[model samples]
Target: MCTYLHGPRQGGMYYFRRGIPAPLRSIIGKREFLISLGVKDREQAKRMIPQYTTETQAILDAAASHGPDTAPSPMRAAADFALWQNKQEAAEYQYQHSMEQEEAAIAREPLVSALEQKLKLSVDKLSPEEQAAKDIIDNLKFELKLSQEKRMPERAGGERPENSSNAKGQLKQSGAAGPVSSAQTSISAMYEGYATQPGLREATVRQFRSIINHLINFLGHDIANQVSSDDLIRWRQFLQKEAAVKGKPRSAQTINNSYLAAASVTFDYGFNERLIPKNPVALVGKVRAEKKIRLRSPDFTKAERKAILSASLSIDAGRRSAQLVGALRWVPWLCAYTGARVNEMTQLRREDITKIDDVWAVEITPVAGDVKTDEARLVPIHEHLIEQGFLEYIDACPEGPLFYDPDKSGVGLQRGQYKRVGMRLAEWVRGLGIGQVGDRSLQPNHAWRHTFKTICLEAGIEERAMDYMQGHASRGVGRTYGSNTLPMLQVQLAKFPRFELG
Candidate 1:
């Protein structure tokens, strides 16, 4: 008498519930399939049984044939789930709802008898063709009735489950297909929970997701708890040897900072939640790289500095969009004097440049975009920048961001517009033959930050004041007590010497 129908919950809606086969659950990435029947009427719901059963079986068959090759992409899995759900809903209306002939005939008998009585006609007196059509309709109704009576016995028996909550009402699966234990939990599954943890930013969540996905792909399975420290060491080795051995991209520092860092935090989260016994990633050491002796400092060489500054001054506005031209022209200069990150300058609004107590300063605030420390600081503008018409450019610009147009950037891209400005500027600088340090490419925008801090220290500016201007976190409890006023920052900036572009 089981109908495979569930609910009549608070909303009085019914759903067709079925358990996925245990062997295929890992591949499909779910324990069961729950398709809503979208009806209060038992009869209407019963009519949908055949189509739902057929479609779901086909989906299961497809997954079984493909095996683990069908393991879901974390980025697209939610979207795919929604799309499949929509397909099921659309299929409901599209089904022909064809009835079995014998069942159809039996079901239609009463209606046929009533019609004959009302019209005062007998079937025996009908023409040959009319009689033939009548016979076919009777046979179809008979077959449809028989099919439903067999398929949905609960409807035929005039019975339904008490409610959706009861043990008897729920669809049962094999023992292996029951709730996944923490140790059996896949990294993809754990990530679903980890991704919702508070205080993580959108960019951070995105970065973590990418790292987890990469790990999943490399391991060929999503099980995080089972991954030992040995597995992690191998992953590090693979990343470092990727370029020469596997034809994949290579990085040693990135392997430590990004890859291992992401996995370590994820495992830590799992351990804290008691989802895993312990964090294995914590045991793995960083990837080792051969040391390269640098002839010059990490800062941009003086010739490189002069080339970048002089190129920025000559950047043609006619060749590029106004935002790109603006970023290319002034961001380098801003970074050179303030020691603020490149992104801080690229995200600048015209309003962010203000006169505080008659001294021009830039506000590196989270209100503009992401600040690395999530705190704002006032960076005093240098006299050299003012001399090079920086203030005139600010005044001439429109009301919004100085570097990028917000309107052109699509939804959820507010934080990324300034980032794109930095990217575009880097590409432009590369064209100018700057930012190269031997085999490595120095970050064009960041080179100025290194240059600025070095200049400040050499010019006898106080370290604390330089740190304050650059938005670096105060090192000690004592340093956190006082605020650096605009006058203090301006004094620090005064000592920074002007670049001789010749």
Candidate 2:
């Protein structure tokens, strides 16, 4: 029989069947009765209950309505719903698997990780200052990476597009941002220009050239333009590795000098040429070399000076061409007395020597553009120069070169001729078993300047006046009025005992 449901007096529904048991009827509340009656609202529930009861009564009256052979099982319907859910779950899992495979393929490519490896190696070997420079390079690399990622087109539902052949090409092109070859070219040009100057020698140019060339060769041509911050890091690694391989990792001082020379010239040239907007090489750190100040005086001892002069006279007597020997003998002794660089000494002329205040003095006016450091300076002659027949030598010519060339055919003392003479003098001194002349186990013309400074310092000369005498560029109080007066300089110089040269 069909069941009918009706609402409670308080507005909830209840279900009932015709001739149903009183106990079952009491258990069915109005809410459950309305749900079973398949009516969503109170009005529908009231109407549906009476109609359902009438229809159930009619069906009950027919003998075939409740036949035992026609009923459907509830368990069969539940099994069908479970199968549908399994199909939906399998479809979702397949979609997720496809996405994971795409991500794995992108990660397998080599180009993505190459730049990162390069940077890590480069930064590992730098000093603190150099590491700061590497840091800037690293930032630039990061910028390039981000820019490349931004330019990539997006896919469906905010997913990133897979890496394609065209995208890889674009990334490769973006990676070619550094200008290593240009840097090398600029450095070569700078060294060539610097070597042309009178004071900068060819050997110095060659040494700097070697350093630049080595760096260029180390970074291969194919990857030269593609130098990222990481490539520089790798270069630092290469330098240390090479040093260890050679069994002399070189002092920090040497390596520092090499790097400084490389960086300074490269950046200076790049800045001047407007190549990269700013100097990239300038970020490298400086190397600190130990500074040792020797305090012993530098005058030739009485015996040593006598032996040098005696050797000089012997050479003068034996050799027909005494110009070189004579010049060496007098110039070094003159430097001992007057304190001047070999280059400065070679530029001396008869016009520079003058008598002031009834005493002979040298008027050293460094011609405006002639000085090595590009700063002009002046120094006065000492009484010892006059006493040692220097005045007599100058008087012989009066207007030409004080140390005139009898053979007047070649260039005078410019272009390292004076340096050659100094070398010869060093060889001669070694032959006579004299004392060690200079540092580095090589005879250098600069020793004379050193010797002068040391002698003046030991004699208790004022530090400022000594600095002025040596043409050292120093700035401070009292030094502001560094006078170029011969009388004033002579007064200070006269305080030191005359340097006897035999």
Candidate 3:
């Protein structure tokens, strides 16, 4: 995103060029790095140079940091993949075989337990037949337990090892069992390892990857140990101030989130590995919230709801509207009825909407992507929603998100926030003049929860039941004894009065 062009050359058209650093020249196997901007006009070339410059710099940086032999060769990677496939097949076979054995053992347990109970009085005191039965049962249980332990395949050691040779090459590159991580590990190298760490959520890792990618471009082929606190400060400052000046400024929350993303993963990884003496991000301060971004509404006023519905339906209805996010049409109705999150509605597949014990419901869960509570729950589709051609919409596509394009179902930054499915929903709400509830602002697509809760509570539905419908955990003993069933939730949801958008 450099405004001024730094590298230039002439060919059939103008091209971007960079001379490889002298020390790294042999590793790159080239004197000068080059890429055509694919245009002749100065303005066109300038516009096109950023991408070409970015890509060429990336290639040069990789060569400088990792050289050519740091990672597994292509043939070696393919061989490792083959090994992994074989391991998977073997694991599948083991799993099925183990399951069969476990089933047989479980099926025999009832008879065994019964026989054992029958002989429990005393081996000698029991009848001869009962004693014999106990002996047989005891032996059967012991044999079953032992056989299971002996036959169960232990987990493969150390996650998908690259078919021995590739592993050896990697080991050789890392310096013959010197330590878990080499002293020379680059920032990029550290990120690759950290991203795969156990217990890190996939969603979180992705955020880290995004944050780290930005950091790398700033650091420029920096090694893990070479990055100083100053470097972190610059990166954080760049993200907080400079980067966004060119476009939309990242919110305080975005800045802080980016900070945490890097600190928790990249810096933490380097520190844990002893590659860096201290975490540079540990002292980084959180960005202050200078302005409010109400992502969720405290409550959608009846008037705001009407405006939203009117604007939504009035547009090129049901066609992906340019004025609003993909959900401008059906999302409001779904949110109003079910009280589900925007993503909860947007990420739903046709299969996600199915009858559970005769109650037609949408499974508002994390199957497609991350959910708020990380727990799946059932929200019965309102009769009003079904009546409004919602079922027809669902029927059209039997798979993928109901409110999003199928091809772009799983696409987006941090999970469909910036994909072709559409524009940001909050902006639409703001555009509709549905800005805030009292002091609080309405988050783009989040206010529906407030609306549903208010509506349902006023309509005689219990708060606890509403919580269940909205996928929020309920308090007290009710959660322990009371169940969250489709039929039960359907009744509470039915109490929600459907809106007349027209």
Candidate 4:
């Protein structure tokens, strides 16, 4: 009877289930689509349903409307799903492998001692299964010995011993021996290991790799552990002396945040994984920004805010996609009131808009896109927005994302698409000739977050409430203890003064 859930199968895992529409089933070559949600918990499985439903429904609707010729072929869909499943499984395997490696390192001495004791004590009394396990362990020990002996001669510039007893095969299968030792692991290899950490987005992987590539290019050698503090410092100096982009020299902030931060984080991963002995990059002190750069305000000036808000209302719907126009119309206003990062507004789904006990609210959720804090929060719909027919706008919007069409988003990378929406909006704002300061066009989308904080302070809104509503973590550990309920937020939001856009 469930719409998209079928399970409590053998392992308590749930399956995503949906019947193919009768008309399109023949074209798609399936009666229904069923795939494991891979979650054992019912609530977690249910939370996953909307995304699956949206994606599956999108494909089905396309096939129905455009026919099989225009829509994705069944094979293409199957291939794409297979690729995603493989990536998910690979990520899981990588995490498990990493944990096993760490556990082996920590328990090595005790485990070997215990195994030796066990082998000395009961041999004939053991069950067949236990006896089999003991035999495998014995083979593993022999393989380890052979692997070590094979490497010792190679280190002494002698030929490896030819194994007669399947020692080489066992060593290879058991991963008791590898070509790349921990000390000699390349930076690229370390990145490959680091990048496999679960929940890392495509964009993040690209960024980290880009930064690490710069380091590799500078160093001339790629060994991970061989990187020293002086090497990092020289790279820092090189980056500082040269322009990373355009003709302008890389700023101190850029050097610190992007170059050093990336190196530190990636090397920390390498160090933790035993690929590297230590993180040398961490020893490099923070780069000091120019005084002017350090003092610059990220907030939009009053005139700039007025210009942006005014421009939002007047975007030519004729000139842009309906989704972009809708985003141009409302996202700025949402950010102006809520102090939300622009992607939060752009990723808004129609379902995220709802009334909480008579007060209308917008749910900023990670399910829509990446929330920086990775937690969902509700920002009460500003009275001014409601007055401007925001609810009416919501009523007219289709069932999914209010701003961008996922179909038009190219890769269906939700984070990337939503991020592009914010970027596009910033470009649109720049087109209006606002936020232009010297060579840099100020961060048009981010300005709202800064402006919103200032507005809250001026309106005497409590910092805690502002932090909660804006999806910012509380400053102190003690403040994280309690819940910030909808009613409480709504009451706090009422204190915000509505913008006089006239």
Local accuracy of candidate 1 as per-residue lDDT tens digits, 356-398 = 9889989989888878777888888898898989999999999
Q: TM-score per candidate, in order?
A: 0.60, 0.48, 0.54, 0.60
Candidate 2's residue-wise lDDT over 128-167, tens digit each? 7767756887786677556544533321111111221110
Q: How many Å off is the CA of 11 in candidate 3?
A: 65
Descending-TM-score candidate ranking: 4, 1, 3, 2
lDDT of each: 0.65, 0.46, 0.57, 0.67
Best lDDT among the predictions, by candidate number: 4
Model 2: lowest-lDDT 10 consecutive positions: 159-168
lDDT of 3: 0.57
- The TM-score obtained by model 3 is 0.54
* Residue 18 displacement (Å), model 3: 54
How much is 23 displaced in model 4, in angstroms?
78
Clashing pairs in 3: 294-443, 295-443, 296-443, 426-444
lDDT of 3 by residue, 1-502 (tens): 5443433332335545556577765443334534444455677777766665554455445555563335534333322322222222222212111211222333444465556566768676888888787788689667755654553343111111222221112222222323333335566677877877775555556555655766765665435655655667677677767645225556566565444445545765664454543344533434556866656547877777888877766555445443234367777777888888666776667788888698888887777765757788887888987886777866765455555554432322224432223234555666666663233455546668888888987899978779877877665443547677777877777777878765
Candidate 2 off by > 4 Å: 1-255, 271-274, 277-306, 317-320, 356-359, 363-372, 397-414, 435-445, 500-502
